[model samples]
Target chain A: MNSMTSAVLDEGKVVLETRQLTKSFGGLVAVNSANYRFIERQAHAIIGPNGAGKSTFVNLLTGHFPPSSGEILFKGQRITDFPAHKVSRLGVGRSYQKTNVFPVFTCFENCRLAAQAQLPTSMRFLRPAAMYKEVNERADWALDLCGLKSRGDRVAGSMSYGEQRQLEIGMVLATGPEILVLDEPLAGMGKEESERMVGLLKDLARRFTLILIEHDMDAVFSIAEVLTVMVNGTVLESGPVETIRASKAVQDAYLGDGAEAY
Target chain B: MSRLPRSLSILLSVAIILLGAYPLFGDVLFPNKHAFLMQKLTGIMIMAVMAMSLDLLVGVAGLVSMGHAAFFGLGGYMLAMLSPEYSAANLWVVLPAALVVVAIASAMVGYLSIRTSGIYFIMVTLAFGQMGFYFFNDSKLAGGSDGAYIMVKPAVEILGVSLLNLGDKRTLYYVGLGALVGVYLLLRVVLASPFGRVVSAIGVNENRVRGLGFDPVAYKLLAFTIGGTIAGLAGFLAAIQYGFVNPATLSWHHSGEALVMVILGGMGTLFGPAIGAFVFELAKMGFESVTEHWLLPMGAMIIGIVLLLPKGVGGLLLQLFSGRSKMEGGQ
Candidate 1:
């Protein structure tokens, strides 16, 4: 995994690059100046303790939180000040830390809405929504990919928590994004569910650029080829998974929280 | 997929056919009854259109407005101002003129109002409605407090063919009915469209919709404009029905009552508002004939209905029929 990651990075395969990204709320600087480059079609896991700015970092990249001063380039094109919708239309999709979905709508409807978002005729007033065959097909493909094909008719709110998380990611997939930002996709899941999500993430990383923020260390280590450890509003270190695991600073700041007991 | 449920589609079709055929035997059906039945039905149809128009904003787009009556009054005022007695016009001339005028006014209002959400949106809409109300109430150009009269009902002759004689009461009644059905179909098609999906999606989770590359404001503004235009049509019918336009048409109370009807019928359900209008208007007439203080019983009945059916009569009907129809599960 490390050799593969370095090879991809060396080949100039960077898809999303941020330079000196900074965000502040009054006296509290949620994210300090951070420079990073994410390789194309690679799973990059961001791990940190509470208030370590991992979420804020993801937010900055995805346009949920505007950086105080920074430049974000997607595929070498400047997207520093683009709104979330504009960024999304440029094929960058993201899921929230909290499962955000149209709860009253069915799984299929939720996916279909996402799929129809970027279509030219999405605003057509007289055409039936079901008549959009491409959108429907994309939604179906996303559902199948997320293992929600059988549960497509179920109302989103009624679905189990783990399934809701899957649906959240599935919605982003339905949008046909080239890059995906999964903000704590595996949060609050049971052992079996987290493992299942980890497997799904591994499979997705092959076809899509994945930037994940997760607290599950085991899952992170299992699937993430590259690791970026954030601590106290700054990036402590970023490198291959093994280098992060071997770093003394990373061990002391995050991995070493209860290392002695283990 | 079917646009409506099997039961609902059948019910809707039967209702439209029955209402369409009502004018044919209207005299024989109620020979001994009051001759004002056709006139009353026309009034009810106008209110139904208004109610449904508001539903597009409140139920589908999640925009609760308190000044929809402004558009209603705008249409009426246009008709009164453009009447033969006032400015010499025909139906073909006034209808589009009124719609265009209302569309511009609604666009201006919606552009400002759509920026606000929830209670602020309601207040903004109410303020706009009052602005229109006071303008007509204080202006002497349209008769002010005494209101203005549209003496000529505006003839409808298309290219020398007398397709509709608006001067006749039966003709006006049929036209009103046709307008009601036409507006209903128009809204139905829109609600089923991709635009409607986005509008409903906005109503659910606007942030999520935004994340999916959809701008909720544009869809919402479009909905507001369409809704306002349809309400303007209702206002035009009302003006034709009574040959009068007044400040009361644009009153905040009128907007409030329309909101009440939308809620009472079911906000998101397309057919609910019309059902709500029917029940509300008929009940008002029934109660008014029996007692002077009709509001007491009317209030109690509405409260009872609200408590009993939280989703409204249309929702209740949907729930009852949806159990047997698997096709309506997602919708």
Candidate 2:
């Protein structure tokens, strides 16, 4: 497993790093020369105010957007030029801020599509899709992990929003990623659904390396081993959760209602 | 979207049976008009095959191709060119040649068209199809606007012994039926395959599919090529049936009509488009027999169908057959 060679978050080896990475749309700089490092096995949370470069930063790492300039390295291998599919194949699975599950397909099929991507090529034509025993097992594993095992036969579109969010995470899990990038696992969720997702995240933290972008302070504080705070397309503060919470500069940056939440 | 109801499935099976056994009772059923009716039925079946192939792109892959007839016409042209002036060409030799030529043409067109999506895709494919049309229409070498003809129809022959003669209307009718059935089964199997699941998945959500780590373009191209190859098969059969290959076959009008058939019968279901071809042609003939101006009535009927049955006749049948008519029909 590449996981064996990669850092254990405690072992102090960087799994993903961005160096002077930048993205600009016309004159507006979305992500401006931001440098960030994510260690393996750590649950890292990125928190920022609205319009902060958090989403753009994640897009760069996942290869959804090729940076205007700079570089990204995964397990010390240069991956800045890779496209989204290639980046994903390199064990960097990402869940969208918006729910992106296949709507008309059943929940099982949604997860199956993700699991099927692990196959060397999905160009296989002669054999029936159902005959892939290992892929089916992987899908079941993901579904059970995401707590949607019983809802396997249900169509994704017909499901509640909370359930669709769970399926979103479920799809990323089916990809068997070494490091997971979740844009917002708790956005627009009710208290109970949020708690369930928080519990799921806590459980996942023990196994896979995670990079999360979430506005929910309580969940962030409880789950993250380290936190990176961004403001206006740049990193403001980043360190252990306790250290960032105590920093005067970090406090000043969050002046007003944002400071009270912190 | 799921399984058809038992009764409706049985009804489809009976239709197949009737189509297969029609020749046996043709003389008794139509008497003096038997030969004419058989030829007409054969024509419907060939169109059905073309419609079924187009459904692969429109229904399954969610790629609306406006140049589908370019591939269809190429297949017919292949048969015409391959056929000897004084003797019938061997079916084995001519079929593969036509299929290969059309396959290459479609791959090139698909490769180019895939670069553009949405309305641009439609325009690009149409442009390519029109190029084919004008090339055949303006060039006198291939018979110009008058089109080319196969003087001797293709027959399955091996070692100088003729096994099946497509020149005979009865033989051609059964052959066309065979092609329709073969294409149906092939598509059904393909849809159930892993490749098919990805293509259909592309239709629903391409971005999500890309996020899942599959190259959407490669999948789309493969689906397009397969559809084109099958459409060519229909065109090849059309050439043999009519003993002619014309520029109109490659026209955008032909592609638009085939697309209409796909939407009319039901875009997603294979059986729907084939049934669409059958119904569309019969309706045309019925209208033609009644009035000199058939296009006006046919146009009105198509408009009525699109307005009333948004999912097409195949979709309506799917709802009824799957027993979800009441719950889903209002939608």
Candidate 3:
């Protein structure tokens, strides 16, 4: 019992930890008893077949939906039932799978707004916000980082799907979160777009702890340091790429026939 | 120095000069016409300012409130109540005191109402507004249902010369215009600010704003309070203009009227509400002159506008202007 307790304590060093986190929507159990840990500042990829509760897990971590039972610890602090805004303030940022953005605003304005959330007061109505040098500088920096400097003036809804995805990630990055959970960042992109996103993710992983949910095996294998495979609301396997590739359990759950091939 | 377009700026300057000269040259054109027109203009201007304040929340912030008239009525009644007791008709004292009281009242109401969104927000605001109406109606101290009448009007004692006497039609008109212009300028500054962008972003997608690290609720509540405060200012002006404050001032119908004005003019645009207020008031005046059942036609017009022009007259004007610009480019 003492040894088990110490093992749990060791896992606490990770940026995010879930102990028996579960969620049910009336008749359907969206996420079952799931114990998960993601190491600090490391690229952790959660790959799974359809209806594996991966999206549900992301929602739970980001406070989009409350968990039925369990505890979510972020950097040793329990935030299992924190509101979405509180979670964001506590260094948890997430991107929706469905490309959520302020459609009417310019890309720069969108990024600036995202960055402004960290400011002392977003409620200063009388002061001229455009003249705020720090906010302008930060917005410019975020736009440049996301490769949207030239397209900053363009409205978000008018942008191409790939650009919107990039902007979505840029929006998350502007929040300055220690933990970034991206839900299928490369959902509906072509080969080149996927590769570009993978490169961006690789760059991002160096500074921020990343939890990426992806169906794109090539992208996942290329970037992930540690991989977690979920199957039917349960984590089927979790290990390094090589171990995951060799494991028959992982093969049957996720990477079908010829397990060691990848 | 380079300036705004020649035609637009020239037109605006000419209009202002003409309006300023109207009072001076009053007796020359149709004798009593100037007084009647000025009086009508003042009422329209006050209503326009009220509508614009509501637009700040309904249009920009995407909060549909049905209790806004409570603040307006409260401000007006407070001024009416205090004016008689204190004999304070100075703009500096009465205006600020009324505004401050109304703002505090609005803040309290907004704090409670902002907890619920969508239909709940609308219903909650409506509930609070009704409460305000009942309180004023039952209060024997302020004449209860009979309402209170203001004997003194807000005036600026400028170097022994009374600049804005509410009794003087021409003076009242200028004051109303000045208030309208001030509100418009203030709104323009706010809409262009970062806070404005944040609120607009909230309107577009609140969840995104949250993920970006903003507490959308706090910003929204602040906007609600500001909107209520401005509406109260308009109410204060209205009470002084009419020399009366009654239960009708705080009614849901008044709230609906303000919303209609916003919708008729334009929701998101700065000067749209003013345009809407003028059009609505003019339409009502025309309808009343033609038939006794003016409400039927007015209601039909509002319904028609809501159905046909979802973006309002300002949006339609914007579309026309943009289209014209495109045609000019082609030429």
10 residues in a row with least lDDT, candidate 1 chain B: B322-331
Residue B121 lDDT (model 3): 93
lDDT accuracy of residue B322 in candidate 1: 79
- Candidate 2 local lDDT, B11-103, one digit each (tens): 888999999999999899889999999999998999999999999998988899999999999899889888898887888888998899899
Q: What does candidate 3's lDDT look like per residue over A139-184, in tens digits?
A: 7887887778899989899999889999998888777688889999
Error (Å) of candidate 2 at residue A146 is 0.8
TM-score of each: 0.94, 0.96, 0.90
**Sorted on DockQ, highest at the top, how do the candidates line up?**
1, 2, 3
Positional deviation of residue A39's Cα in model 3 after best superposition, in angstroms? 1.9
Candidate 3's residue-wise lDDT over B1-331, tens digit each?
0122445445545755675676777668858676676677788889988999999988888899999999999989888877855454777778889889988988899889887889999999999999999999997868899999888776677776865567777767787878888897788778767778788777778877776777788888888888999999999888878888999899999999898899898887756677799889999989998999999999899889878888787666565544445677632
- Point out where model 1 deviates above 4 Å: A1-11, A257-262, B24-29, B86-88, B324-331
Model 1 per-residue lDDT tens digits across residues B1-331: 1245688778878987887787777778898653587788889888999999999999988999999999999999999988878443678888999999999999999999998998899999999999999999999879997899987768777787777768788888888888888898988898888899999888888888889998788899999999999999999889988989899999999998898899899988878899899889889999999999999999998999899989999988787777544566733
Q: Which ten residues in a row have the lowest lDDT in candidate 3 chain A?
A: A1-10
What candidate 2 gets wrong by more than 4 Å, as runs, is A1-10, A255-262, B1-7, B323-331
**DockQ for each of the predicted structures, in order?**
0.78, 0.78, 0.62
Pairs in clash, predicted candidate 3: none
Docking class of 2: medium
- The lDDT-based order of candidates, best leading, equals 2, 1, 3
Higher-ranked by TM-score: 1 or 2? 2
On a 0 to 1 DockQ scale, where is model 2? 0.78
